[model samples]
Target: MKNEELRIKKSGFWLLASGFWLLASGFWLLASGFYILASGFWLLASGFWLLPPTFILHYPLLIIHC
Candidate 1:
């Protein structure tokens, strides 16, 4: 009974540890996902902001060609 109790306690400890790590990894993934999404939006916004300057610089070329 002593050995069985010890084994059960060890199993419980492992279960708790695994659960903690699982929760930690879940939060890490969520944070990274949010970061990726935010960076995607930032890149999209920056692309739009660059368009006007690009168009202005190339406006004469476009008009001459047209």
Candidate 2:
């Protein structure tokens, strides 16, 4: 029972961390997209690095938000 509780706690922590990372990535991607549009190479590079996770997170929201 104690082990089960520990596992649950760990799982919750991971979930929270994952959510934070996803949000951070989304912000980074948004910033990157703006930079790329403005033709800033460093921003474009940063955006490219951020793109995959942003794309993953953004797709679902696009359908829902729009």
Candidate 3:
């Protein structure tokens, strides 16, 4: 039905948004990891502080597998 189609569309939009957010967060983590690895203790400490909350926020979205 039309309502069902609308619901599906809405869900699709949400999925796409979630995917974008996850990708962004992943890139952030990767860049942070590399900075941590390449640089000395200060960069490593900063990267550690910054990356975890991003990972934690996106962990459930990553599990979505969509």
Question: What stretches of model 3 exceed 4 Å from their correct place?
Answer: 41-66
TM-score of each: 0.76, 0.57, 0.55
Q: In candidate 1, where is summed lDDT lowest over 10 consecutive residues? A: 48-57
TM-score, prediction 3: 0.55
Assess each prediction's global lDDT (C-alpha) against the native: 0.95, 0.90, 0.89
Sort order, TM-score high to low: 1, 2, 3
Q: Candidate 1 vs candidate 2: which has greater lDDT?
A: 1
Question: What is the descending lDDT order?
Answer: 1, 2, 3
Any runs in candidate 2 off by more than 4 Å, and if so which?
Answer: 40-66
Residue range 1-66, candidate 2, lDDT tens digits: 999999999999999999999999999999989977877877777877887987867878999998
Q: Enumerate clash totals for all models, in the order shown.
A: 0, 0, 0
Task: Estimate candidate 3's alpha-carbon lDDT, on a 0 to 1 scale.
Answer: 0.89
Tens digits of per-residue lDDT for model 1 on 5-48? 99999999999999999999999999999999999999988987
